[model samples]
Target: MNRRVKEGTYKGKKFNAICHFFGYQARGSLPSKFDCDYAYVLGHVCYHILAAGLNGYMATITNLRNPVNKWRCGAAPITAMMTVRRWSQNPGTASIGKPAIHPATVDLKGKAYELLRQNATKFLLDDIYRNPGPLQFDGPGADSKAVTLCVEDQDYMGRIKKLQEYLDKIRTIVKPGCSQEVLKAALSVMASVTEVLSVMSSSPINGQSSL
Candidate 1:
């Protein structure tokens, strides 16, 4: 067990202690539907990789907003995901240790961090506690999902709306009597808009601020 010194003194004695731990309970609890689905998909991807005799690779499945059938699956070499770390045992040693998988860290520039930063001042003073409740298998809460998924879906819908508006304008102006030059210009504009939308849709949804 690990112990740490707690700040401040109780009756002029420094309080050194092992903190209360909740990790065991958290790990033992039933996983949410999102977690279950994610694990299931990853398992299938791993099976495929093994069947193909692949090694030193990690399976990945993205596009969580879509159905599992529409999710993209691929593998990346484990080495590509790793970073070199200095050995703690020999602080002065250089280039003597092996690389390890890079740990995931909170992105300071991400939407989640931005949201927290924006409201941090108020949060520090207020004892605010939000209970999301337990994960649901049915009813209204069943449809509740991650903010990232919701934001991506909203962005996609917004793009569709813009496309529809463009189409409506084209329909009004491009008729049987319209000139070839005008039709060509309209087609050019449509193509440009389509390209932009395609790029936006294909871009990774990295917890965008629009959430």
Candidate 2:
């Protein structure tokens, strides 16, 4: 990548040769609003998982497009989310396969990438730039958040809404005089759903505890 950037020419113009890496500087900067909220909720979720005595699991909070309170908390088995990859143990040792969580990549078929693909020509030649400016806590820019979060939230909500409807149907069909065990199980499930919704309805900024 560096070689291409240093030697490549676009159109009829030759590019200047300068290689700079900004990863360290960017990583050392102060957290943005999104970063702060995301980290806080993730930490809270991890605490809950630990308190629940869960092991070999990763804490996650989804639906981040919504407020922190609305974020959905869940735990996923680490192995379930990882893939096996070949890695060298040492220079003298043989390579071994290891399970690892790889960094996520942009989906070529996704809308975001598709839009970028469509505008590639324009972006290559036109020196158009958009300054997002500093991250804000309140106002118009704050409202304009990550598109990925919104997309994930929409997908999650759709599935959850369907499950809720199924649960409601089951409730309607079940008799009022159902067995104690059955009623207890149903109530437990209902309570769990209600708790999630209650959390969603409250505001994290108002000191409401998020699951």
Candidate 3:
């Protein structure tokens, strides 16, 4: 219900949809989308994982065929990831967190920085333009979100090892051989059992789950 919830959610979803659509349109395939490290790229891939996994659980990969059936309807509480603070340089309060840009990390973007250099004439140029804007909460664009959630069912390295195993296991329960009703139940159960642990290496809690 909060304005930030709507804005943040809309911003995240629109960014992902446009990014994936353009990528797929260009490459005629979609991979790396499954495990992009960039926040924006990762968000799209995560939604696919969530939606597809949910559907595969539901025995309905057909929804993915539509590419518009995976819309996430809930908004995470903004408080969980943000804080407001006052600063002397500017008299107003500011919301600060990992989302804020840092000049120091510019070089870390690596190849992505290269893309801008190569395409700056086109990307940074004016006149030739297309802005899809925040997608309307209806139609094909409404489905995915840019927000990246770490579900943590399996460890990153562990999951890569087991993804093939799990993918195989899921195929049997989903698709033509199994019932959709049962698949939904299966996916939900698996996701619940495999939630990412709240490991805070920065704090004393370390491996323990934060309350």
Compare the candidates by lDDT and give the number of the best one: 2
Candidates arranged by lDDT, highest first: 2, 1, 3
Model 1: residue 134 alpha-carbon error in angstroms: 3.1
lDDT of 1 by residue, 27-124 (tens): 88567676788898899989999999999888886667765566677777777655555444566665344566556777787776777788899889
Model 2 Cα lDDT, one tens digit per residue, 2-41: 5665686334556577999989998896666788888887
User: Candidate 3 — what's its lDDT?
Assistant: 0.42
- Sort all candidates by TM-score, best to worst: 2, 1, 3
How much is the lDDT of residue 39 in candidate 1?
Answer: 91
In candidate 1, which residue ranges exceed 4 Å CA deviation?
1-28, 86-94, 121-133, 148-211
* lDDT against true structure, model 2: 0.69
lDDT of 3 by residue, 68-123 (tens): 33422222333333332322445575623222211233543455566557667886
Top candidate (TM-score): 2
Each model's lDDT:
0.68, 0.69, 0.42
TM-score of 3: 0.22
Number of residue pairs clashing in candidate 1, backbone atoms closer than 3 angstroms, sequence gap of 3 or more or interchain: 0
- Which model, 2 or 3, shows the larger TM-score? 2
